[model samples]
Target: MLKNIKTESFYDLCIEESLFLEENVEESLKYLYEHGYRTIAINQSINDDNLGAQKKSKGSNKKVKNSEVPPPIDLSPLIETVDKLNLRGFQIFNRLTITYSNSETFNKFIKSNHYKKYHLIAIIPTTPEAHNYACSSAVEADIYSYNPENKFTARLTRKMYNKIVQHGYYFELQYSHAIEDSTKRKNLIHVSHMYHSTGKSKNVFFSSGAKNLNLIRNPYDILSLGFLFGLNELQCKSCVQHTPQQVIIHSVGRRHGKALFFVENVEETQENDHNDLSNCEPQKKKIKMIVDADVET
Candidate 1:
């Protein structure tokens, strides 16, 4: 038997790891829920520099184990709190965001089982080669995110954007930094313009990327903010609702094959089979015998 997994209607996919460390994290979640975010992903960012350091410390020849990657934060306690609060259908998913300058190191990280623990995998390529490799190569990832605070070093051409969209990857635009600082807002808009020029803002979605509770905004506000990112009303709406849902579905499919449902085999007991047979009455069949005779003709 196959079944569909239930996902919440609204999502704010990029809540930062710092927010989870706060003393009032539960309160923060409550506020977000109140604001109508039913699903949220806590993002843990890893840089290629850190991976290189670990590789150097362990010797370059040795295969890096799962321990080399930063483990996902324990969300059990937060889940319990949410349960106690009676937040129905609320979902918290773990996300791994790798910012890589080197494609080899990125490949090695993705090859490890540790990276699979996350519900969503996002990559931020710092160099042109890394960016091209990420887009063109058969990398296992769900989202392509960029740092709004920093200027993009990698060239984002039209073909690259098209390839990314064709690969079923969503480009994330974090709104929190835009809300926090003018300089970051400018940089964020510049990046958004790039998306607009290259791809006409296709396959783009909005995430909070919120460091604290204060940075979080309602979905409607995010919809309006989407306009500044070159998204029209319908496209803006999709960024918050339809596109995020598709991103989650894509991540699920990435981890668990392309099938919408998992298959399970159910065995029938002999007694049940006998009972089923007993309910049916047997019918007698009459057969007419045909005699073929090569007559005198």
Candidate 2:
């Protein structure tokens, strides 16, 4: 849908590294800004073990009732970097990727008070059960992430992928993983094929997913890379632009449990319509004569 709308530049929504960290804050943002990235996100990964519960639910699936949760990640460090670089129209967002092995853990984390803190929430489902949950309509997250480095034995059928795309779920393709190993590149291509089978490859979110400056590539270069991976021109282009924007929009809405408040093209109306009033002429003040009661009465 955003194919016609031209973007001056594209966004790298999944930066595996942090822009606020003392180790690479300056270099990361500088490289991204130089490469024409208007927006970037810092993604932190929390493993399944850290999901606050070691036990799984023994019964059939139902709405999550209650469970303890791990401590929330401290995002206070990234707060200052929100507008760090003086780059024009730059944005930095905090995102968290949680890994879950079972639906119970996923449910508990979703029910946490800390769920809404991040601008984006992504899930890394290591098992088929978790994968089902991740792809289901009941899951409320921006991205269902699969690492290119990992091997996937579970199959994602066409029906499941279609349903996921229909529910506005997006998948992330990390470039850093592809760059690190040839096996990962093959894995990425294979998975891309599965997703393309859905006929809604527009739901893909392509990103550097870089933890270091060396791994980062310009958005245009990534677009070229997408072409090599079997993505059509439109899908590749929207990967960095429209797809991520929609992800953020939906994630923000999910965070608030509703859409964020916004308004545009609001104009102030004239208190009285001068043009309508121009048709009327002011009437002369009515004159009244009072009887001289003081002298006669």
Candidate 3:
């Protein structure tokens, strides 16, 4: 955890705060802060349907083609709100949530510089083809977020899950639905069970995805919900703690262009790695060893 962050277990997952009709982003954030949520990612949703609608509304006959990256929903308003709140040790991140329709959507997405502006990117594969692509190498995203109401269905394979994890993408379960209705709770549990059946619940993260502060659950309360959703005690806790931590680290990697581990702008030293055998070693060292934390650390 960062030095200023006080709440250890809470990462609010990702939410579309910009979509809220009457909620005060600042007040909602302050309420979250009071409840010990130290980090939150504000998501902007994107997909072909919405993207095309904008053009249609503008009366532009230009058919939506490839290499299209939707313009970001400005965060300046929310940022100003944060500044007004005068909160400290709170981490706010801009996130893009892409609902993929095809490889072209993702292909165009990665090529677009707009995505680079976000601290994190999440994807919802609405179709089986998109889901398979996400589990494969066709897309880039930190979190695989699917709402229970979306009723996502696909045959998940253990190998696919492992491959996605290998690429640093983790699965996310949004809890607002489960908190609201019994049917949503049952569906969420079913999804979790399917996820666990294919892959272990090790890196599964839980999110509130709450538009109103009333819908939000405390960090520990989330763990209790996870247990109801079929996670074990450790896995349940990790959903709020370990898994969210991984999401943050993964986001940093994307923002920094490390792709997980590569350090940027590292200068080569003139001296050899070993002191006494300085001359024996090459002038440029193959790698430098130093005391530091892992990319996630």
After superposing candidate 3, which stretches have Cα over 4 Å from the reference? Answer: 1-9, 19-23, 50-86, 258-297
In model 1, the Cα lDDT at residue 195 comes to 91
Candidate 1 lDDT over 88-165, as tens digits, reads 878888899998887788877877667778888999888888888878847778899998767888888888888888
lDDT of 2 at 169: 72
- lDDT to native, each model: 0.80, 0.68, 0.70
Model 2 score (lDDT): 0.68
* TM-score of every model versus the real structure: 0.82, 0.74, 0.76
Range of the 10 consecutive residues with the lowest summed lDDT in candidate 1: 288-297
Give, for candidate 3, the lowest lDDT window spanning 10 residues.
288-297
Per candidate, the number of residue pairs that clash is 0, 0, 0
Q: Which of the predicted structures, 2 or 3, would earn the higher lDDT when compared with the native?
A: 3
The regions of model 2 sitting more than 4 angstroms off are 1-8, 50-84, 258-297
Question: In model 1, which regions exceed 4 Å deviation?
Answer: 1-4, 57-67, 258-261, 264-297
Query: What TM-score would you give candidate 2 relative to the actual structure?
Result: 0.74
lDDT of 3 by residue, 239-292 (tens): 877778678766665565443344333344344345526567545644433222
Q: What tens digits encode model 2's per-residue C-alpha lDDT throughout 128-187?
A: 888887777688877878877778766788788877776667888888778877999888
In model 1, how many backbone clashes occur? 0
